[model samples]
Target: MPTQNQSLLDALNACVAACEHCATACLQEDDVKMMVGCIRLDRDCADICALTARFVARDSAHAQHLLKECAEICKACGDECEKHGAHMQHCQECAVACRRCEEACRAGLAA
Candidate 1:
């Protein structure tokens, strides 16, 4: 991994972890039905982040494209997570992580 890409990599990893945790926690919530969208977005965000991290780490030719897609997914996930942030600690944490990852992805694209 390039030295400059380290921050992006870190953000991707953190987002993946946060999304997975949020998804699991959402599944356990009493109102699981209402959390379906959040859980789905969390899972999607985690998958994209993980894949993007791999591409970025290897300096793949498609990294830029993945970064764009990752940013979009992260933004969506963050928005969804933010909806439940006031009542759910997991969602709050996930929202923060997703926002950071989204910023990192945008930065990576700019670079």
Candidate 2:
């Protein structure tokens, strides 16, 4: 596979792990209610990222469409995670991963 595609796949995998971890951590937080949105977005992002990665890995014709959608979800997740980044290490980490994944997905689509 092309380097761009490989990088995007890696980013998606990283984001999947980050979002999964972040969501679980958020549920354990003292203020779980406040983190509900973040948690929801995290789970959604993780699922999409995983599916996008698979589409890219298989060199599917739908990869580009999935990448575009993944980028949008990543950005949304990043925005939500950023709101709690300062207070939560997991959110901070997740936000960074989401941004990286978003960029990678965009780059893959452009390629």
Candidate 3:
């Protein structure tokens, strides 16, 4: 992969990890029902990030399109996570990761 893709790839991977972690942690929370939305978005965000990373890794023709979709999902996931961040460390971390990934995706599109 080109050096230009490295940062985005790293961000994507980190977001995937963070989302997965967040989802798992949310499931174990005292009120799992309250975390349903966060859990759902975390899973969705992780899947999209993973897919986008694969597309970018291979320099796929559809990578740019995926990047745009990835950014949108990341933003949504980050926003959802942020809602619970005040009391959830996992959500806070996930939100930060999602934000970084969203910014990276936007930068990739700009490039």
Q: Write the per-residue lDDT of candidate 2 for residues 1-111, one digit (tens) a residue.
A: 888778888999999999999999999999999999999999999999999999999999999999999999999999999999998999999999999999999888788
What is the Cα-based TM-score of model 3? 0.98
Candidate 3 lDDT by residue in tens digits, 54-94: 99999999999999999999999999999999999999999
* Local lDDT at 42 for model 1: 98
Please provide TM-scores, in order, for all candidate models, with all chains considered together: 0.98, 0.98, 0.98
Candidate 3 pairs with clashing backbones: none
User: Against the true structure, candidate 2 has what lDDT?
Assistant: 0.95
User: Candidate 1 clashing pairs?
Assistant: none
Supply every candidate's count of residue pairs whose N, Cα or C atoms clash at under 3 angstroms.
0, 0, 0
Runs in model 1 deviating more than 4 A are none
- In candidate 2, residue 23 scores what lDDT? 100
Local error of candidate 3 at 56, Å?
A: 0.3
lDDT of 1 by residue, 8-109 (tens): 999999999999999999999999999999999999999999999999999999999999999999999999999999999999999999999999999999
